[model samples]
Target: MSGHVIAIDGGGTSCRAALADAEGRVLGRGKRGSANIFTTSDTIGENIAAAAREAVCDAGLEGLPLKSIPAFLGLAGINVGERQRELAKALPFADTKFVHDGVIALQGALGDEDGVIAILGTGSVYLSRAGGVSRSIGGWGFAIGDQASGAVIGRALLQQALLAHDGVREHTPLSRAVMKRFEGNPEAMVEFAQQTARPADYGAFAPLMFEHDEKGDVLARDILLDAVRDITMALDAIVFEGCERLCLLGGLAGEYRKRLSPRHSAILQEPRGDALSGAVQLALRAFPPQAVGENG
Candidate 1:
């Protein structure tokens, strides 16, 4: 039998895994909850394994040799230096690689090819890889950065609503929509803000911003437009020195694709794979030489 590869794209919102052959043809796909190390505990390896196992099972494989598998993980909090070691002990494959989720996203979108990816989801980040060199922009987390994200937009919406309530701005559709989302209870709104975790939770409401904008809410339109601007700027910052390839990925990115400016759309490229596929690709690279037909 041909060897298999496992790729994982673990993020603040969810974990996805894909099983594939050396040719990159997919075998199975699986999904689970967030596997972000910074947001969760030291059990990140366990969580990632669970998600990968689920994908493997979904692909109708069991009792497979884990050691022979090659795996790649794009996890949210793992940086380039020593922090990756913490994850090395936890993954299933004999050989595994870890990078920031953005790098994984970029790889998924472009493979070994060079390009940039602007990801907007529970979090926002810009990544570019060209001529085997890579760079990043933003993705500092919710506290300091993540400018063009759902949390940022949600926070802005709430702030604007409060301002409207205080008569600082005129009433708008967003105020009504925001109030409705929280069931018209300010306390519930506060509770939602305090209790929820991750950028995706707030991003869940991103559609409302678009809807409000479509309905002619100036504030909502401004917020949406500004989000695009922020993402574009981040992309511009990291694009390869001679970049001609770029792509936008994520739930929000797909939803807002039609609304993106022509300049943004012109450079977009289709993704060659997904984070899960990238994980499987990583896994395949770890396979034993005899099994993979070559040294990984």
Candidate 2:
């Protein structure tokens, strides 16, 4: 493990790290709390360091100096504003490339081949690659973006319930079910939605949307269909750009694959690997065996 590198999938719920040698073989893995630059930038460096240390220890390479090792971090919201610079400045590793989490996802899934990735978890983001060019769409965090995301679905479900309560919309079984979670108290729902809910907190309601959709609930179907529209549009943009291979990632991936417009079904295929795998690929490319030297 002389020329080992760290590959990190810096996510909203957890930071996952993998220790890999110059050849891109993973030797160990580690996980820690959220590494979101948008919401948890203060702790990302600490979390990443801890996770990398854990990975090194897991690989029985605790004697190595982490500061000298190269690392590739794939993080969410890195493309927005100055977040990338702020993170790059704060990173513990001097040899590191901090990129959009979607970059790693695309690499993991496609391995440098032209393709598209739509990650539809607590938050959502879409990325595409073609002819060595990378492009991304919609990763603005939960407040304004994250379309087709679990958090968005959950928040929308709650909104529907509130709308029904106010006579702004018809009360459906799905809406009633949501209201019931708050003990039928509109005020309680308001308090949670407006004050206490994080993206993950709102994303907690996504499974319920799926469950109700299966039962043919009107509100659930409506909300899910709307979310699918967002995903479909993103897919369309990339596919039209000449990316024929498509891989959907995250919690809502399967459900969305089954529901997307039939036009995309033929291009959909399974991923070869995940974001961490892609990180290792990037790390290996950045520091090859010849570059690192065989003896470290």
Best by lDDT: 2
Give all candidates' CA lDDT scores: 0.74, 0.86
Model 1 collision count: 17
The sequence of per-residue lDDT tens digits that candidate 1 reaches over residues 20-133 is 766667778777788777666566677777867876787788777656666777888676346678678766675687768887677668888888887877777888787888
Please give the range of 10 consecutive residues that has the lowest summed lDDT in model 1.
Answer: 286-295
lDDT tens per residue, model 2, 150-231: 8898999998899999999999888998999999999999899878988888998998889989999999999998998888
Q: Candidate 2: deviation at residue 264, Å?
A: 0.8
Against the true structure, candidate 1 reaches a TM-score of 0.85
Top TM-score hit = 2
Regions of candidate 1 where Cα sits further than 4 Å from its true position? 1-3, 65-70, 80-84, 90-95, 286-288, 291-296
